[model samples]
Target: MNDAVRELYSENRYPDLSHPVTDISRLWVSARAGGLERLPEPAACRVLELGCAGGQNLLPLAARYPKSEFTGLDYSDTAIRKARQASYEAGLHNIRFEAADLEHWRPSHPCDFLIAHGVFSWVPDEVKTRVLDLCGQVLSDNGVACISYNTLPGWSLRSGLVPLVKALANNPAAAGLGDSVESVAASLADMAGGGTAHAANVQAICRDMVKKGPTVLPFDDFAPVCDAVYFAQFASWAGERGLRYLGEARLQDNLPDGISPHAFDRLAPLATDPILLQQTLDLLSGRTHRNSLFCRVDAMLEDGMTTGVVMNFAAGRGLVELPPVESRVVGLFRQLLEEIAPSCLAMQELVERTADRLGAGWEPSRHGRELTGWIYQAARLGGIELRSEPLEIRSHSMAAPRLSALNLHFAAAGRPVVDARHFPCRFPDGHERLLAAMNGSRAADELAEHARAEFPELDFHRWLAHLAERGIVE
Candidate 1:
């Protein structure tokens, strides 16, 4: 095979697989079920993952929903072997991993869900076509398929340098391909020497590549055949296969503030055509990545949960701090809620509600009230509490703006847990004070003594136990 093909098959070429499949599956299940609070009635949902390296994503879903069957396919034997080993070690029986070229393989039965992450942008046109065709054929009437790709407009600026970099690296007489690419990048940085426009342009392209190249280029499992397509072309391509753009898999990316104002202004008017708008926005912003959802035209479109509602509810009950929602936007949210039918609880409805609310008025207080109600309703349905303690619950409609992102660590029923990723913690309540006291600086006994003096009712030991279980403390 070719050098590129060899690199793609090597297991050590890329970072360890860490897509957070368990979290993603939970969100998918919650969204499909209507909201995060309600678990969709158990159904035999079959999931198919394309280019499922090491089966990391598939295995988690299979484990979480034992009733749901999962099948993962990859072209790499190394990946398949690792996946099999991991499955055997974990004793997972609900998943199967196959080493088959997706371009030639076909599923025997229809799938309830399809997921292809980091696959679309890197595969050859023939493979891309087959993947979509398979999705169309295998996806059930009510299923959803997620396909992530690198888009045009955003990619154009960054990709403009690909040819130059590749050409420079291909000069085998000079150095090896990998060494040449790195050397050229370094040379360009030095030549620019810091301020000239030529240097700036070269530096910008180099920086973009440096940041994203490792994730998508020759290191990608399907890199050998990748032919990145523009957003508009991709949408058209999917449309031809009878799949409609459903929105983005990463809900945050679809929000108005996700892109620059100039891009939003240009694309907002095209909202009636979501696919076109998404393409235009992506191009304008020079976005190189996308996480898109597509549904079959004949499939029944179910109203699904909205991220706004989920975040709002999570914030209101102290599960998380409220994210920054501008005062002007809050007003529009209220108006939208008023117009929507109470029973019309769908993903589209939430979007429309947000648009209506923002377009109607700008009252922060009223908007906050409505958001709180939505959160309470969501919590009631999901079976999770908004707040674990009376101290954690906020009685007023005041927003506790997010100060920092928190790293969430979770443990299975009996597993020992500790926070692995260091995240900035923002406490809206005295939780910050409590957190400060519990920092490694103090022993548990000392912290408990302080807790008794400050908040007598608070169980310091129990709090420490909870923190330990969550992997928040060592």
Candidate 2:
């Protein structure tokens, strides 16, 4: 099974790109949200990424944090070779990659942060055991580990399509999943019928896989081992290995969408077991996958509940996805957030602001819970972010905008450059004069001044802002 899997990957190498959720900042925030204290800082920490592929995820992190050390391990030599080459090209020195399976690849020192993004659910049972065991053995006292997996009930229908995908992978004439997925999905949609759960699942998966690119096909949808377990079952496995559930990496994933407050109130009491409660919510919402955080059981027991990390986070984003409500307080809070668009405020500052704005009737000691509750709910609903550090986006575009030369080269060649967000995106056609003008030298400002005539419709300042947003400039 291992040889076959290794051969499959060598034949089809996965494309490299950043997986932001696996970033230690995200794991730190999740752990902090769950009441952990004194975890390592993201700026300078020991990090490990299992199944790191071509190092797209870890390499960016290494570049971002020059003070940090990183190690990437994968079973495939092909993936590790490419990762090493990429790190060298990126001029990164703080990272290393090795071709070794989780079962036998033990590091001398434990990592402050460990990531197994797409590995846990796609390997054999013994390998899965090793993953948990290694995590428990090598994770630091207060360190957090991230693992993602397919969920049950929601995956029940999708698992049926896995065989078909695997068959396509074995086919000789079939070139790749790009075209193959379209045809298979089309036939499956017809068989599943319109408006059926099976049809919806097929459509959603196909769309997402295509958007994520070819790297997803063999590894995610048609791996040799594709297992799905309930949240409670996974928690039990972690507990047996001396690890405990911290929280969901994507906090909003914790919420059972489409449930009314009244209905949830009645159901919440019956499901008091936190693990069982999350599993029930998964079943209720038909959740397909989960990004879970775990820590040593002793670490969790030692440090009890505290909201210091969460409360100090610089919160931003708006209250766009608030829960169903008609409270005047909620309305006032939402309005305040809207007025401060594109700017993050300290949690305490937000709390104090809310207290002051609501007249003398709103006491910070008592009614602050109202503001905090709304903040938590809004965050869970994917409306806002609670981060230890604020993003360094420019408020205004630069007059003489400086862009990465490599990025401009890609733009001119019609290739997508990894953006500031670390996602791949390309500039559309018809920006020839503009791209040519941005030679990364001061000549950009002068040449752009003339090209501004040739391209009168172009808003130079706004265009630079767009580039800045992509991390290509500024």
Candidate 3:
């Protein structure tokens, strides 16, 4: 980390900063979906996190995969303190947090997966290069790395706010970074006043800045060295460092669904090359942020699905039944959703269940193919997910569900959200109370009795089953 970078975070302290996507399993699955080679499984893989503030992002993952080893490094002492305290409280023995600058730190052993989210674009060029260098030095042969940064065309517009923010931030009377940025935003909106086209544009931009919240306003926008890299240049830089650009962590971004057919057709021929197509897409979509993945130069990134790929839902959104082109599969799909909705089941389990539901007369081989296609189509539509590992289901003899240590800790600490198999769950009105009350001693009846104080109509058993379906209740 750069001295100024360290000083900035150490002073202001980014509150509740964690990237849920940084989970190695999520990255591996995304990379595989993008047609990368087989990578290490999450269970036994060694994972490392750069700029891991308070371990909020990494600790939950650590708790989830206790068999895996996790290491979190950050230059800020305050970040290390909070992260260490949380680890102790959660009783996570497989992970360690250290306060060390990236410049001086070296990995003791090659890691299967590494992540550096929200750290790439904020530091100096030298540190950015050092990040790539460390990835080259430490990543396993088949390892995948996720590095997220602000990209161009999208940043081209947002960058205009930087100078305005810096100027106002210089004002001594301004309360702080958040306050100064807010002041500048208001002033810009006032100056725009909305009569001219440019004025309306400025006001829209101000609205975006306002929604970014206080932490982002100071650290990302107004910082002295906030840099934005074009996707092509970033890819070239990675190539120079002996790493090959794989794809984005968000699988949907790599697909062609976001743009119009005419626009894609026009741009496609002009940039026949895949890398150039990526740059063109950035321009077409006005994409400002990206979560990128990379692998060793020799690694072959095939352009199709890998065999035996496993996926699971990240959260429970009422499962959207696939649109019925034929009415025969509708009831079966609905039943399938009901069975797997509560837990993350494997692809084979899904196929078998579909076959069983269709009855003994149905041929398993023929129907399995049809069901697989439907499930994948549904997954592409966000109704299901492809998991790199099976969801870790916990066993409890009591009627009340046993929530994971991390989820319980998060709920007790008033963290408005928690992770369920890499999906985020925002606490509903009485959800936190229900989660916090699962101390291993509370049975379903006792939990319902406790929950009735705040939620008179709450059914603890149904709620427990709901949480189980989302993988929130262990």
Candidate 4:
């Protein structure tokens, strides 16, 4: 069964660039914010990713942190071959992709981080068990493991589409499955004629699934082996395997959203318990998917949540401080943005600077809770990010911008997510020319001359400032 699964993926090839949130650094930031401590530093950590397709996720990590070691396991020979080729092209020497299966493979050494994204619910029961068991075997004492899977209740609505899809298109692995899914979906919609509610619902789902392309339809929604569990059942399953829930990779999900003002009033009793709280929130949000982080059951808990790490995403992408709605904290948010707008800062530093800008005797400890809450809001908005390491902003004095080899290669290849310092960047307009100019051989004046000729309207200094702020160049 597992071999067949591999064959399908290898032949079909799921070759798109994976999302950056699956990066261990993102998990590290979320875990620290969620009150887990003593995490292995990203620079020095060893990482293992099960079902890592084409090394899209780990190659950036290897490129960013030269000291870290990354090993990706995938049963698809085609995927592994492409991953190896990519690493070779990027000149990344710290990563390896091996063609191996979860149920049969053994770990050579313990890893500080283990990632299993998009693999849990898609594989067979035995393979899923082996994945969890492998995490237990390979994870270090203080290691953090991140696993993403489809969840119940939220997925309950979507699950109905599976049987309907299969009934129409019996063989999910057929060559034109994508086209078949689209055709059957149209036929179903025509049959419904906007009368039967269930038929209408199924047709709507099929129409939505068609956008994902035929290649993705089988494994994503109509796969033969996909399974989902409620949050509680998943927690119990992990506990039985010697792992405990830490938090979701997205911190906001782990915390209450205050949408229902009395939610905490009603669920406060279960708030102290991680699993119960997660399950309750799952019900509230109708969450269909989860990116969960866990650690060894005996791993030490922190005294309090960390304020040490800085956020990763660049500011102004989706983070903005609105005046009319959140008026109360708008002033503080505005002040912070003005002070640290294209530069990254630690929470404590941001607070102190806010205090200094405000007036005399303003202490960070005095406004600790309020400041932390605002920072959390800013983080949620994507306006501010928290990271353990501060970025080194490039200045005009520097001879040339120091871009990573991976970023250079990605820019040339037009890959969407490029490695920027230790972070992944998915800028809208793209940064090809800017990256191309950062060959380390060009001096500041020479680069400026080149930029002026290429881009007449662009503010060369502003471009450099933006690149520096994004940690794309140092």
Candidate 5:
């Protein structure tokens, strides 16, 4: 283990701070499940998140799938503390967080869904093997595990610079690796003369780092502790552990159609082996980030269906149903949906019917327009149903539209609103009211007080849980 890197992570330092959301996962899962295949029902699914930092990704999932239980584990005490604090502040009972070394920690039970983001490439080889072994041992027979990592080719260029940067830092005495990296970066920037080739190269690298900004992993803490693996090695390792590669979490990364005709033609022969083909494609494309799904050989792929179908059925739509929809003058909605899937005859008919009902020139309500677009794509691909009713009038709201209304509706209904909207029962009603009240103005405590009045039946803790799930008033 690189003590420097371990120290860096120990201090809760990693350049990238972003977390995963099901909205993004839904798209990937939908694409992998054959573009529109209905997902398996979400109820009572057990999920485990490895290296779940501060519960940023897992907590929202717990809130959304109240029927599903979630557990998150991380090695960092600081991160565990933050995650626990966030969960406590939110008042969530379905989610649990624990700090444990991945090598020895054992799950009390098998998980139906497993996720390990930003950990595969950082842990030591022994720890990585333990993680893969745990996934195989603890994942339910029908479970799906998402593992993200840094790949080769693209990292070839970036990784080449790591040694140079570390050498330039030269100060072993620096208390923090971040301080060393910044010092080196600054020195390189200063040495780059007015217009020399060497200076230009330095400037270019600096410029790329700046553009990547938050996306780049900082050296101070993370650089010393991380280990990146090639796609081929990773796939082979997991395959040995009884996990078969499903597909990339980012669906677009797997589409040969997106590659140049010549590249696609050259890579086409490898398609017989999905893992090899994807690995080669990723290498060819110089992919830096990937979310790969895996399952046991006997595990059936999740067909994206769920009870939320009732919401669509109640709305008089079918698996192929499309609601009336129109683009804004800017065609933003149209463009977004177009990227989703090709329009089908059923969708066109629905649009025509809606146009007839509202005048031909009528523009769809922003919420209606976005929802229709998502539903149209989902239907075309047979993905999960886009349930839930409208909350915000427009897409560009301060709070998530789904969170605002769906959460409140669930609280009012006195039960989970499984099909309330695009997301599962992630939000509660009091949070929706609080979101409306905040509009980026109200203080957290003030919002909590207002929620107490509106949902007297819900205690302060419940309201806080709703608030934490949405990351509102926090």
Candidate 6:
């Protein structure tokens, strides 16, 4: 073990980050979308995370799913010390943490879900191989693994500059990163005479790195080793170890509809192989990183979505349309679905009702394919979700908007609130200021009256609907 590495982490703990894509529900759903029906339920499963600094990502899951088991492993003793304390203080009984070196730590039993977020690209080649090998060995028969990394062609430009960034980072004379980053950006500002995509790529990456600032720079740009590889190369490594790519943890990445069909169509014929197609897509799309999901090579994964396998998707509950959701065709469905908060309707009923709501804009016979594509894409984008089962929440719904005991508990404790789907969500801050009035007894207007002191400008009724839509309220 490198003492310097441990010391670096002891002083500079990486940010406490949580990703919806890393959540079991999202991973299970992504697997379901890929036609794997037999994976463990998100509500009751065993999850293990490698490189889990402070256990921020796994902590919330353990709290949200009491029956499930979670274990986080990290090499940093300080981080593990903090994670265990946090877990204990939160009264969480199902989660555990180990200060383990990934090179030597071994799981006593297989985990249903394995996560190695941001570990592959930063480690040495041998450690990277061991990560894939460990997944192939310790992953349960029905497990899914999410291994995220910096990808090549896209990340090539940024990674090539790492050495330079590190060299500049060594200068103690510079008091802050702003001036140092500016010097780097200024140096590259004239690349390709400042007008080409290559030049723009360099400048954009430099700015993004700077925006992350000092908190991220020490471990990232100035780390001893930060590497990136081609998507195909990474997949090949996993494949050699008996793990095969299933899909992406971020569902939207698996869908090609984000880009114009014409553009995608133009590139499809050039790359006949799917993996090559993905590489070409990344190159063209300027994607610098990927969160690829993998499963055992022999797993029963298919090409299309199937029934009997659960898929629970949901749309946001904002009163007005939200960005990352600009398709006019899906707007009506988003509006109609937002009202169905605290619950999810079956796809058929949902489609029929939403169609009726559309009236003249949608016709069944002409728009079947279009409608399917729209909602499915919307679901992928989280504008709407498709699920095989109704959400199991302890709170009552609709007539009297009440916060769930869990949500109320989280809010009262000054912890971040998680949506019904178990994603750590960004709710309007000072929500605790309004939670005391949401006990199912207060009328909407009365609640609005109380909210006026803190949120006079917010559309109270719509905000309530938004709360329900996000599954924050009962």
RMSD each, Å? 11.3, 4.5, 4.7, 5.6, 10.8, 5.9
Give the per-residue lDDT digits (tens) of candidate 6, residues 66-184: 99999999888888987787777668899999998888887799998999987887777767877888999998888889998987777777777766665655567543432465455
TM-score of 2: 0.82
The sequence of per-residue lDDT tens digits that candidate 3 reaches over residues 1-474 is 567776788798775645766767667777776666757778888999988877878887888788999999988888898788878888999999999878778889998888998888998888898898998888888888899899987787678777866677677765443456676686666667889855776787787777776767777776767889999999998888888877777655565345886786687675447689899888777778888998888766675553344323232213444455573453575566565554455556655566677776566555545555555555555555556655544323346567677767767876644556555565566577678877677777877787777787777677676666556664
Question: What would the per-residue lDDT of candidate 5 be over residues 1-474, giving only the tens digit for each residue?
Answer: 346546766864433133532333343343334322333335567888888866656666676667778888987788788767766655678889898888879879987678887777776777788889988898777676778777775565556666776665676653343455555555566667549754665655554554444324453122554556688888898888998777755433455223585887787788687667877777656566677777776665544433233223211222343344454422433333343332222333334445554455665565345545465344443332322221112212233222333233333433223221232333454443444444445555665567568776666545445444333322
TM-score of 1: 0.61
TM-scores of the models, in the order given? 0.61, 0.82, 0.81, 0.78, 0.62, 0.75
Model 2 residue 464 CA deviation in Å: 4.0
**lDDT for residue 149 in candidate 2, whole number 0-100:** 90
Off by over 4 Å in 2: 164-179, 190-193, 209-215, 258-260, 301-309, 318-320, 323-343, 349-362, 403-439, 442-463, 470-472
The candidate 5 region of ten consecutive residues with least summed lDDT is: 387-396
Best by lDDT: 3
Candidate 5's C-alpha runs over 4 A off are 1-6, 13-18, 21-39, 171-180, 183-208, 211-222, 256-258, 301-474
Clashes of each: 14, 1, 6, 11, 23, 5
- Candidate 6 is scored at a TM of 0.75
lDDT of 5 at 58: 69
Q: What's the ranking of the predictions by TM-score, best on top?
A: 2, 3, 4, 6, 5, 1
Q: Per-residue lDDT of 1-474 in model 1, one digit per residue for the tens?
A: 345554666644343343532234333533343322322222367788888876655664565457878888988888888778766756678889999987678788887678887777676666778888987888777667778777665556456576677777777664643465655665565566658755676776675455544544555322555456777788788888988776665444554233655656666678677767776666545566777777777755445554444442222121323343445554444344334312123333454456554655534456545654554443433322221111121112111111111111111111112121112222334555656433245566776777799788888677665454333554
Candidate 2 per-residue lDDT, tens place, 1-474, comes to 376566776787775556767766656766777766767888888999888987767876777678989999987788898778767755779999999967777788988898988888888788889988988898999888999899998888678766775476457765433246645554444555548665676777655655555556666776667899888888999999899887888776667565666766877786447797787778878888888989888785334323344465667774355555686665666676666645566777766676677777886555666666666667777787666555555666565665554445444544445554456664446664466456556554675577577777777667776766555565
How would you encode candidate 4's per-residue C-alpha lDDT over 244-362 as one tens digit per residue? 88887765556534347477568878867868788888878667788899889888777554444333222221244443334333356456656555555554555555677666645
Residue 165 in candidate 1, Cα distance off native in Å: 2.7
